[model samples]
Target chain A: MKRRAFMLSVGGAAAGMVLLPRMAFAEAGKIDWYTSSDQNILDFWTNVVKPKFEAANPGVTLNLVDAGDAAGQTAIGERALAAMQTKTDPQADYFESADWRLPAGAADAGLYVNIKEAGLSNYSRINPLAFDGDYSVPYRGSQVLLAYDTTKLDPANAPKTFADLVTWIKANPGQFIYNRPDKGGSGGNFVRRAILEANGKDLGKFKIDNYTQEAGDAALNPAWEILKDLSGSLFDNGAYTSGNTQSIQLLGQSAITMIPAWSDQAIQAINTGVLPETTGLVQLQDLALPGGFSRSVILSNGVNKDAALKLADFILTEEVQSAVLSELGGFPGVAWDYVSQDLREKYADVIPTTIPTFPGGDWEKAINDGWYRNVAPNVDRAA
Target chain B: MSLTPASDIVGKKPGRGLTGLLLVAIPVLLVCWMVIWPIISAIGRTLWLPNDGGTGRSFSVETYKFFFSDQYSLNNLYVTLWTTGVCAVLLVLICLPIALYLRFAKGRLAAYVQGLAIFPMFVPSIILSYAIIRVLGPNGTVDLLLNSVGLPHIRSPYLTPWGPVIGLVWDNIPLTVLILISGLGAVSNQSIEAARDVGAGRFAVLWHIILPRISNSILVAVSFTVLGIFSSFTLPYVLGPAAPEMMGPFMQRTFRDLNDPTNAITQAVIAFAFCIVFGLFYVRSVAKNRAR
Candidate 1:
């Protein structure tokens, strides 16, 4: 009798587990998305973006993998490349990066069906800078800025140019920070801007820019001299090379007064209570930072390219745009004029007019050579 | 130097039994395939990169010129060699006394101390670097406490190259001590008593008896430690800013950073060749000692 009772109880428990939840979710189709967005934002993409898409396309399931943090933007692209090379099936259906890695073989993936052919009328909504061949599309963007603690300095006395930022760093020893370009932070862009500023070139003329012998020597010589003169005042004699996390921590502790911070880092610091409310971000007036792009590319190794386009179209929707901006802190890379006033106002602070880009085809090579591995300890050592 | 007890049973056949052979082959091949292969491929791609994407990517000097002509790369190499050489020697010297003490000391207390000595090995290098910084940085625990105690604050350890060297040596000590203890164990108590009876003082006994008996193990441990420190990447990357860049970072730049696998491979092969030449001598020394 006791054995029968236990068996009956076991059967009852199994039945309850099945019947207690939304059993309709099992009928969904799976669309795999591989992305490098942050955890919380990705959770929003999975929970908010997936369900909304699945609700529209009932049989499709969405499986979103956090591939970005697992390795990096490069490694994720390499994994896809390997999959493509080996002709592996069921490779990630969609791929994305803050910067479109593997930009060389993007079109060779033989995956993405054109947004026009895929019936994506919303392509008109995206910016021309982002709209291209079916291989990839810009995800979203945030303007890189020089973030600082206003409490440490009056706004009236705030830095207006890269030169000013450098001066401020020198005046306050051991309190400035930023990551290197090779280290995956936008340090390269800042370094380039410094070179551009030293050359006295107009910001608009900065494109596919080559670091000439003159540029490498003349522009960087002053920068290096200044850095060398100011080196003793840097954080631990200019030894503390750190990413946003460490820099932010130091900023919170009043250890660093300045950094070349991206919008997301500043936003995250504010939200997480790392940055005080008095903290401020300012775009450099003289030198534009043409760095930082979030490219959400269409990748279909085996899944439905047509279906993937449907998802892409859905993601670029005004409603989805609003959701992504509010939830993920993503600024639009489209003809963002049509966005709601609320969206415009929220992202207004972060967006720069012309974010510096790799001006030349060999942009990475230029920066790696130009920036001294994106970390010219002395501005003079740029070559 | 493992003995073949049943070699007489097989006249001309010179080999281990199946179990012994499998044990050796499995581990040896596994290492060669996994670790050695990737390392070789990385170096190969760097050194022998084709002028054009086709058949044989023959040898070239462009990669080397690109690597060494730049002051950055040269300085990085300088940093790596200086730090590794200094730290390895320091690691051996510091651990020798600790190893001797652990071997000679009595009771469970010594075991506990020895355990504590090795505990840092379990901590990740990243975490260990942060802890060192927190204690030794300008605003770290030491400075904060010193200030509170009414003493003038001292400079941050981060400002000096010693910050990284000390950290590296600290990380190496436990393994060094372990090697030394195992080596010292091979010195039978009989040998010590024999030396003492001969009117040999403590220093004489250690120099003649202990040193000679355990020299093989010491050599083995030193070989591994020096190479390990040479290959170490992350600790120094974080710890020292002013220090010259090391070989690991240099290789990373040449291949990974430059996307030039050919030159990177050549440099790696050079490093591997350096290791092998020394490794042979080290192994030969051990074999010679064990045979005695």
Candidate 2:
């Protein structure tokens, strides 16, 4: 009887989530928006999306709130969910979240107004593989590119291929720093893919249930052994991948020679004086991994759907795409084909969007392929 | 408060009716809402899950089945248990000697040494761990020095399953020292003088007299260190190898990033249950000791 009462209480609490006020008390005209982008990007979003978007559609407000990176997004999302659970509406209207966060967050919070129901009729051109494409859309892509400090090496000594990078790591001891796969998202994921590729393993034939411990171990054995050797030789003494801002600073400060970084992130570092502008980037010879794209998820707080659509469409248009490309170092989508011609000639040397390739593996097939935890030290060093 | 509590009705004074009620009610209710509610919520979320394990659907024992059914997990459990157990025993063995020395020694040097012994506690564990790695790891300063001297470079075995034991012991020593120091002070001076007058040797005095007097402090320190190591994740995760291996690393992997909250919950449940079982055993022994 006691257990039943307790469980019933729990049910009542959960059902309470449904009773939250969906109404906004903000001034009658404007729609509020929130995003977890960088401050610089937030500046861009508000500068471009708010005033221009608001003027174009009168009485509409675009409130672009910057909520930092993935970690920051998770914290803010939790707070919002807690506030709403107590019969409150979130302060911000629209939120942008990464692909990994939406499933655990948006699905549970019940915050979203289904884009399909809200008259968002088409997004077929965007890769539907985005987190099973159940919620959210592709907003911005953070491509994994190989970037090196010019002060550390001449062009002749610069890394070109996967093999060249490995050789470089080995030759220069205690200098290489890749984020641990389980801790850092961008660098860690890319490194895991690279390890899989380096070993020439098949990504598709992996089964989870009958996953042989030995087989999985053997598959990653070479990579582990290689990493073990490189631990003292090239890896950071601290044993953690640099924090995102710290990584950007490391590149700017020329503390490292070669690092795996998002193309835009690398460019932003250079533009912000965190990294030298002379630092260059290159993609690996064979790998063309999936891009990490951020999405703008519009909430249906009784806002104008047509206006929201117009804003999204305008951002995806050629002129806006060109502006984003020129300012943000963003690679052009099909809409900005005109500007892409000149971009291809000038910046084409660095940014390439030719194909979608991975390190020949799926994360589902290999748990080791996921982001690394910042906790794991170079334990084997002591061993 | 309601009606002067009947007994106090005819007595000298009564409690403040509304103020007292409001104070107790507000804090008790707030505590339940804040801390207790979220823990209950996390545990509750762990228990209930959808059948199909679809997008949001959960698989419950599927997580448990993965953990308990795996041979690797079994090995890790054994390793963790063995490490924690051995560490408790070893911590007593190591700290007892230093504790005994500190108990007897006196003067300015002792005062400085007492403070210095606790210096490790003041410095952050993360910083200390890094220092240990630098001094003890394969290519660290000590090893490098050994190599330069044409000696074989040596790395401590503390990095493996046994490494956490070293860290736990190191962390617990200062605490143990303080506890022991107090217990030793409480030992009757006359009792020690009488034993010595009767021709008790130093070793005999230590074994028969000092140890018994300080047993409570020793038990307290041991229990604390054991519980700490058993529940710890950060040090092992930071200093141990990848999965199919260590408990700390495995718990993090299964639960944290995998979005398999069910598995994380299972691991948590198992840990909670394990801690409770051991805690009860420890308390029972303590009660028995007290009764004696």
Candidate 3:
């Protein structure tokens, strides 16, 4: 090989390596929407959302990537953070079910676009309760509620307050259970409800930003006592389910009559006939069980930032929000008025008037750890 | 057989030493890069503790201290060890009879038994967990059958400590049986015939001849089973109790759910320290076999 030819070949290969990825992203108009949602959400995105979005906006592609779970999404967030700090292509355009505070300061660092001020056309439809922050867009909502087998208990007779739920569990031992608080938000919010009951339902005590270990322990100690007192009423005498799905499965099998479950998962299970047709959902009337909204963030250094923002705005539109209710069995991120009237009437039975949420951060971490340590210390070995 | 070292063999050939070293270096470097490096990095992270208020950093054992001092952490460790020991015993009790039958019994039944013994190896752990749940969980197949027969509700082992034990023993049966059967191959038919000729009964022959020769295989099987069960996450996470969880689920909860990575690493370090004992036994067995 001649020296000139060898150098030319090497240079061409290097340039191709660098420019090929950019060309693919630009020409393909690919927007990678990484989500940590479950199989049903992924199915809804692939089957319904992807096709409609691509048809409406030709030359743009929405690649839905399953970001396994919370931990997996956190790893992706960390990688994006590193790419942003280094001024490199993040390879990630959108993050679904993630928060602006993931890499611990990416939002404040101006690494994420402020979706509210981004002049999205459908910003008027955003629910005030679901409007979490400036740097992220809330796309869908879900909350924890009591799921009961209607064959075992009448829907009208279901427990309406936290106190009534506890009384019902004690009245019918081994007919109720929740998952471990560390495993899913269903059980986590159940524990949170207990904390509220213990503290006179004061939502003001727990704050996301100002968390002190001393105050948290003081608030949580009473809640632990209440939970421990009601432990024997749980399935298998305090053997908690591992996660949300297991609790739902046990209910489906008629092993347990009632459980705290995520509204989206419960409705999906009922709609898909995984849960029995007799299954019913209800919210506590005295103090609403805590709910959460799944947010999507657009990274500033993402390879296709404009396409990602467009997708984000598209998710908040009334059509997609209505699909979130009917197809995915999740609550709409938009206001109830913005959702389709018939679909809203169909789900009126489970629609919550208020979506109270417990603060995360040190408070959540402390509650989960303290639950394992104090409330559920006794191992329920099978007899 | 001449017991000349490989070094001597390479020394006698020209340029073979370099080729042999390169061939060995590839796997050696790969193991160092993949396995040993991550382990060392994890251990360093556990020791790299931040001071109070996140002002300064220093190498400390505070996380280990927390693990040892906390009763909940201690309970998790105890449950993990208990589950591993019980599964090892169950695997042996279940697999040994099948292995012995496969070794001596020659018939279609033996072939079917071998096939059944190795079936779980091809099944993934997630699928295995689901199968176990369907078969043994509440209102599952067992309950349905028992209820149909007018039997009272059976207390299920699922979601209890015994849950992981049952799942792990079933998941591990194939590997243990294969190892034991391979070990039983060392016992020749001629030797059994010779023992029988001397008026030794089957029990006597098995006790004197078969069990003694298969001791190394048994050790290797137990070592591998212990290591696998001790580090297992899926079965335990799905089947085991929420409190007093095995180290796998416990570490996961500490890291992901509880958002305490430093303590999670400490838990991993401690779990690794426990598995190292079995790992050493495995290494020594391999070394002894090589020495022979």
Candidate 4:
């Protein structure tokens, strides 16, 4: 009888060892955050946010999975969609996606949780337009700015409008460059902005979905003409750089004096000594450049729904927004007035007043296809 | 010993048949699971549009039509074919001599050259691309060297098809050289000596005897190089011109950047079809060589 009692005691102890941890974990849920943010932003989150969030909510652990950079994010999104289709739990509770991909890529596919229904407090602080059917919150904003080497070109003489830019390119041939539209969104944005410039006040019509072939041809004709005309004046007589980073590299090497670049990327490049400090950025006054916000999307079927909501709230707080600006060189997710006065003044030129979101996927594909077919062939004709 | 009956021998045939089935079953199952299933799924994807919420499930040739009808799409095939042709020729011309030396010559220099030839195999394709860019880009190492000697700065062709061709050749040389060296090892040196004794010069021996023996290896090298160049993404994406891009990068761009999986699958199917043609040639060459 004593030996039987001892065996029961050992069995009870083994069960207790396993049960205790489970009971402890039951109190504090874990959040898995997958992001495509760069290394610096990831570092900021891990070093700064993770510890504080965990400290405040005891026993809670924040797991940050690096989904990859821009292209990698799309791949993750595709995987997440596949998981959702199979009724399996997605690998991530929250994911960060590029702004341009929203409404067509992730948001349209119903991959994100509705923030309003989730009762996130900071939802109101975000620009309502940034809300993609209340499924995502804008985490950071970037504008396509015309960056130039001040050493090569006088800043005062910089182009103020599309027309002025064309005239300047003609006079200083081979001094300006833009990447291929299909390769990088920055170049794509430049083409879209040029289309806007070409169409004048017909931007709304072009923004519409399901354009007939005749309608698309007529609307995009002037833009093609402008691109073909400007091709002769581009760097290397219309041989465009293949990617956005290449354009910045050429500017740094003084191979070209002017190129279209992302505001945050250009500034970050300067800070990292990739571009010399003499490099300056300017937004065209007459033409509103394409600007959009990268967003934090909470998956609907995420494991830790409450913890994910808490984490989203923590990310949108003023402290994190300030860090995003100071550390990442990104425009704040909140309004400019909400950030420090110094930051507002420092980035006044780049702080986008007229941010234009990308049209849906179909329109984007049409635009890319049209540029390749119509404009690309005529690029070197004049040269 | 007593003689075995015919019925007894027939009874043992079932046991041998069972053993044979056991041996081949695992391999057959593995091939079906790993290769055939995926190929079937890929082919299915080409036929059907994905039911991405809006689009209802239906069989369609729209994807294939879209890909073939577009000139931009067709240019990708042209670029891939051109690059593959150039790289195949270049790899053969460059690797054959080094391979011959490694097989025929016996010295420290041959060993050193062999080491140098295979050294690039260790370097990743992406790193090799960047290295080529650094060496051949505008105002790069080559330009710098030329400038030091007071020569005019020549524009870099590194941003064109030539650049990718150079990188592809450099990357593929090791495999080609290894194959050729193995083929040369099988070429009997005694036969070459006998031919020489009969008034066959070095050129005649190489052309008449060595070439015929190693033709299989040459075919293997050429086929592999063509396949590698056709499907190569990193070298062409990093080095080649934006327009007239290779099929690999073009498919990726169409799929991810354009977010059109159907069109991308169609392109993949076309690429697979090309690979199958080359693969058949490889199989036939090996079969013929083995028969001989």
Q: Of the candidates numbered 3 and 4, which has the greater lDDT value? A: 3
Instruction: Indicate which candidate wins on DockQ.
Output: 3
Q: In TM-score terms, which candidate is top? A: 3
lDDT of candidate 2 over A285-357, digit per residue (tens): 6655335555666544324434555565555555555555566665643323335587657666445654343
> Whose TM-score is higher: candidate 1's or candidate 4's?
4
Residue range with the least summed lDDT across 10 consecutive positions in model 2 chain A:
A369-378
Per-candidate DockQ values are: 0.10, 0.08, 0.31, 0.14
Q: Write the per-residue lDDT of candidate 1 for residues B1-292, one digit (tens) a residue.
A: 2245455354543333433454455456667988888877766666666767687778767776776686776676667678778987887788888888898899999989899889878988888887876787656788889989899868665535566787888888888888889989888889889989989999998899899888787788778777877777666666666335567655666566567666666667656765776588678987897797
Candidate 2, residue B19: Cα displacement in angstroms equals 16
lDDT of 3 by residue, A95-191 (tens): 8878678778778777788887888888878888887778888888888999999999998889998889999999999999898887778888999
Reference-based TM-score of each model: 0.80, 0.60, 0.92, 0.84
Enumerate clash totals for all models, in the order shown: 31, 21, 0, 0
lDDT of 3 by residue, B87-115 (tens): 99999999989999999998899899999
lDDT per residue as tens, model 4, A35-130: 776555677678877887898788779888796555576666676677778877666677765443443456666777777787888766765556
Q: Which tens-of-lDDT digit does each residue in A210-299 have in candidate 1?
A: 646554455456544544555566666555453445556556656567777666667767876878887887887765665655666666
Which regions of candidate 2 deviate over 4 angstroms? A1-87, A91-97, A104-142, A146-159, A163-179, A195-282, A288-383, B1-65, B120-167, B244-249, B285-292
Q: Model 3 off-target regions past 4 Å?
A: A1-28, A379-383, B1-11, B52-59
Which 10-residue window of candidate 3 chain A scores lowest in summed lDDT? A19-28
